[model samples]
Target: MPINSFISLFGRSPIGPMQQHIAKAHECAANLVPFFEAVMAEDWVKVEQVQQEMARLEREADKLKKSVRLSLPKSLFLPVARTDLLELLSVQDKVANRAKDIAGLMLGRQMAIPQTLHAPMRAYVQRTVDASAQALKAMNELDELLEAGFGGREAALVERLVEELEDIEHDTDVMQIGVRQQLFKLEKDLAPVDVMFLYKIIEWIGDVADRAERVGNRLEQLLAR
Candidate 1:
């Protein structure tokens, strides 16, 4: 059977509004990778380029939402599909925005990655990015799983992903505290503004992880129904 037909036989339609939202969310996730990579490399020029790409992706996602709304029947989109799509778009955008905020913080401060904390902090950002991307993938497929009335594995999978994210979040917290302590011990003269900016960037990155974990929780709830 043809690919489309195969999916149709499983009681799913390929031309779903949710699918478009999922694609847009994945685009955000893809954009985040480059942003994290640039930060890790301390490639300031490439960081600006990543920020520009994220802005473009946001515009694309907005256009997609408009197109989807035009095709969908307002009545069919109720508490489930409509709300889920909106939440997905919002969460995806937050990921990109948080990444952009981190880059903006770096640019504004003209701060270079400190040698002592460089490796651990870079690893932390990269891991968080990976978790966010995985969360997006799981969320994007949730509608299909829900519609198919698939086994309990849907919730199980989401739980596992969220658990992994939680683990990473703890590690980030530990690393942040350790780095801050190291900074204070080595240089008591560091600018307050610089410290504030670092805190904001770290908070924003943590927010992205929190949002991704929330998305997983929402998917798990939808799967249970």
Candidate 2:
């Protein structure tokens, strides 16, 4: 089949579906800001609303992931291995999954962000979201990389994006450490269970950035091949 005809028939190139999945995942990550803000205000209603939105976006991203996997042709020729593409999709999907996990944890406990940790927590969330955004941008370049046969300026562009993603993730890690220190300092003032759950929430929020870094690593592996 002609390339354009095959795409028209098959819906889109593999990267297209993958991009949609990452975009949805990014949407889920984007909600973390408002969700955390709501939590800070002790506005359970707004927190629940944001949680629902994250859940909805996560479910939609899951559907897109399934569709992409099922529709991906086994015999279709491409510049990269099918396994690599699948791995990339799986990693990207985890970004959304982590976002939902964070949301669920917050709602389950009605977790409140301590005033001392508010600024650091928000910084952590923003950095994680930024990492996810950069990863998505790198994923967006996959089609272009394919067109360039995975070399030249396109590869250089993605390489730089991956570097930026790594840097953002590192910043989030620092923020996580700082937040943990603050949490520990304030732990004495809170109920023991609240302290435990707060730690869990902070760890899970950091996972979002870790997952985003994994996505970038997967793309780097693809570039290597």
Candidate 3:
């Protein structure tokens, strides 16, 4: 099948459903840092805006999925661009949802991050977001790589993204431990439920990085094929 014909059949294009979702994923990943920073700093207005934007993007992604399902030719798309795009979008969308999930946890628990804990957590999340952005950027170059049908730079870049995400994940674990240690020391003033909520949000946020890493892995697999 001609590439254009395949794309029309499956709703795939240079700036089609997959590209749109991936782009939003990068934006969400980047914005999450400031979203949490706003929470820690007690900036309610910014938090509300970022949270809304995150929710809006996620909803739009879902709509796109439904559009693909109802409008595209399924048999023609299996194991091709449509399937690849769907998988990529699903993974990317998870990051945004996770960010929103963390925000919801903050609201539900009225948990503001400790001042001393802010710096390390902020740095870790920023790194994770950057890694996810890089992963998405790599995805943008995928078509070019496939067209060239040649070099190993794209593969190498994907490997580097995975490594960077691993480092980010490790840093998140360390920060989580440090934050818990400090919280433990001051546990007399805080309720156990609040502490658990805090930990839960942290874990979800960490999963955003994990999802981003998985995106890099998927891109690697697709490019290799």
Candidate 4:
């Protein structure tokens, strides 16, 4: 909740501040590591700990996002159009938003990950977090892009990072399919409602990666401009 990153979301060139914001957003996604562990262990206490922390992080991201909306168009020297910068910020924020959503829904339902799902589900959650991590890595290059005037070597480097993020997201897709297949095999043993929510959880986990890749896509658009 402390979110020291809020100081720079668009302070000057919009690069440094955006970097900070994504770092915070990615923090929410990264928390899923411990969260899934707690869930698999059926440790509701630990689950709540991670969930509360994520809520704090999401709140911080939301505050910074609102700040960006309120503080723009004054003295900030945005290299890209104001709308483009805001779009990137919005995408980055969704990473945290979805992470929070996954935790909230899972906790509220006291959702249990089937024993058969434990392994693939853990891998799935980690891979999704990895995607968000990659998104943050690409955003970290924004300052360098600004230095190079959004051209030359720095822009290329960011493009490579985005490409890697895409690959991670693709891998996530494959994993989701495999996990669903496993779930289908176990569904007859599970309650109909539980099976439905399990599928939804799987989908929401993938949403984390999907939204993370969208951040990279948004940045690519900025680079094109």
RMSD of each: 4.5, 2.0, 3.3, 4.9
Best by lDDT: 2
Per-residue lDDT over 1-225 for candidate 2, one digit per residue giving the tens place of the 0 to 100 score: 444555676556888889999999999998999999999999999999999999999999999999999988885666667788888899999999999999998898888777888888888999999999999999999888887778999999999999999999999999999999999889889999999988988898899999999999998998898
The candidate scoring highest on TM-score is 2
lDDT of 1 by residue, 116-207 (tens): 65666666666666667767667655555654453567656666766676676566667667666666664555577766666676667666
TM-score of 3: 0.80
User: Please, what is the TM-score per model?
Assistant: 0.74, 0.95, 0.80, 0.92
The lDDT values for all models are 0.61, 0.90, 0.68, 0.88
* Model 3 lDDT tens row, 151-178: 4775566566666666766766676677
Model 4 ranges off by over 4 Å: 1-11, 74-76
Worst 10 residues of 1 by lDDT: 71-80
Tens digits of per-residue lDDT, candidate 4, 126-191, equal 999999999999988877676677889888899999999999999999999999999999999999
lDDT of 2 at 157: 98
lDDT of 4: 0.88
Q: Any runs in candidate 2 off by more than 4 Å, and if so which?
A: 1-11
Sort all candidates by TM-score, best to worst. Answer: 2, 4, 3, 1
Number of clashes recorded per candidate:
0, 0, 0, 2
- Positional deviation of residue 196's Cα in model 4 after best superposition, in angstroms: 0.6
**Model 4, residue 185: what's the lDDT?**
98
| lDDT score, candidate 1 | 0.61
